[model samples]
Target: MFLPNPDAEFTGSYERCGLTLKEYQELIKLSLDSRTFLVKQSKQSAFAKLDLYGFKDEMVFLSGSSDNIELLHEIMADYGEDVNQWYQPFTSRIRHIRAMKSQSQYHTQTQTDVFEIA
Candidate 1:
């Protein structure tokens, strides 16, 4: 049996928690939209800076989850005007502090010439 309240949070009563199912759905949608909008803006900002960095032999670094790195790679390739951009920075940032300790100096020197923190 499936009871659909459309506004039911978990059971029939969202009021128990001082909320309604519709409100919960709205909140979730808002959060997702916020995240999506931010990502879009970030990418746009990154792309805008692409011309400043140039797409020559300059090496770029990225640090993030494999999925994010992959997506970033795609973004840089298609919209960043450069396909050789390396995702090493994104991967390196995820490394443990101790692991990055030694590589930090050398990595920073060899990694991105111009990049944004966001």
Candidate 2:
């Protein structure tokens, strides 16, 4: 998830993730291609849902249930590269989102004061 600032010089590799510039570009291209396929399939399948939060700054954000996320990983794996290397950072973000959702549900279920007394 780390990227050099727009004003920073290109060092030829991303130090945080150990990906070369070429590899990063390839990862983005593959992700976009796979997203297109997944969107089409999600539209056709009643049980699957995918939401794309378009790229902002240096990241592309996608939101989906665990099943849909797994489907994306499967498709990415089919592209013949080790998906773990390419997707490690994103998987952690997904886990964060899941935790947030669960916390939200817990708060909603344990509601106490609906109004404040003056």
Candidate 3:
């Protein structure tokens, strides 16, 4: 699910399929620490509020990051399972993700609200 992070300045998370919250958070941290998003800026930082979810018989990853939110959203929007589809943009800038319940034609708000509004 798309959980709000109270610790970090910006909220983000990327959970792996079939893993617990702690495990997925660790993996996301590892990926972020090692993965560089902006070469001009400091090396990639970590994501926040990592969690897990499932669709049908298989599990899917859910995560958020200021640098990678759009990427994550695009990935889920295009390739993620429909039942498990979910995304919540923190703002017009940063995006958040969880599990989606609906797939109808809808317009997203510019707020950090992390729920679907049709």
lDDT of each: 0.41, 0.47, 0.36
On residues 4-112, what C-alpha lDDT tens digit does candidate 1 reach at each position?
Answer: 2333354555435444444445433433223221112221311111222443222323224465556566655655644444344433433443367768888977887
Superpose all Cα atoms of candidate 1 onto the true structure and report the RMSD in Å to 1 decimal.
18.6
For candidate 2, report its TM-score: 0.28
For model 3, how does the per-residue alpha-carbon lDDT over 1-118 read when each residue is reduced to its tens digit? 2222334222232322233455344443443334322111133334343233333212322333354555556656665745345333222123122223122212333335668889
Best-first order by lDDT = 2, 1, 3
Order of models, best TM-score first? 2, 1, 3
Which residue pairs collide in model 3, if any? Answer: 12-48, 12-64, 13-63, 13-64, 14-63, 85-100, 86-100
Local error of candidate 3 at 37, Å? 31
Q: Per-residue lDDT tens digits of candidate 2, residues 13-75?
A: 443435555544434444332432211122131112233555431232333557756745775
lDDT of 1: 0.41
Residue pairs in candidate 1 whose N, alpha carbon or C atoms collide under 3 angstroms = 7-21, 62-89, 62-90, 63-89, 63-90, 64-90
**Whole-structure CA lDDT of model 3:** 0.36
Q: Model 1: residues >4 Å from true position, as ranges? A: 1-8, 12-14, 32-118
Which candidate leads the pack in TM-score?
2
TM-score of each: 0.20, 0.28, 0.16
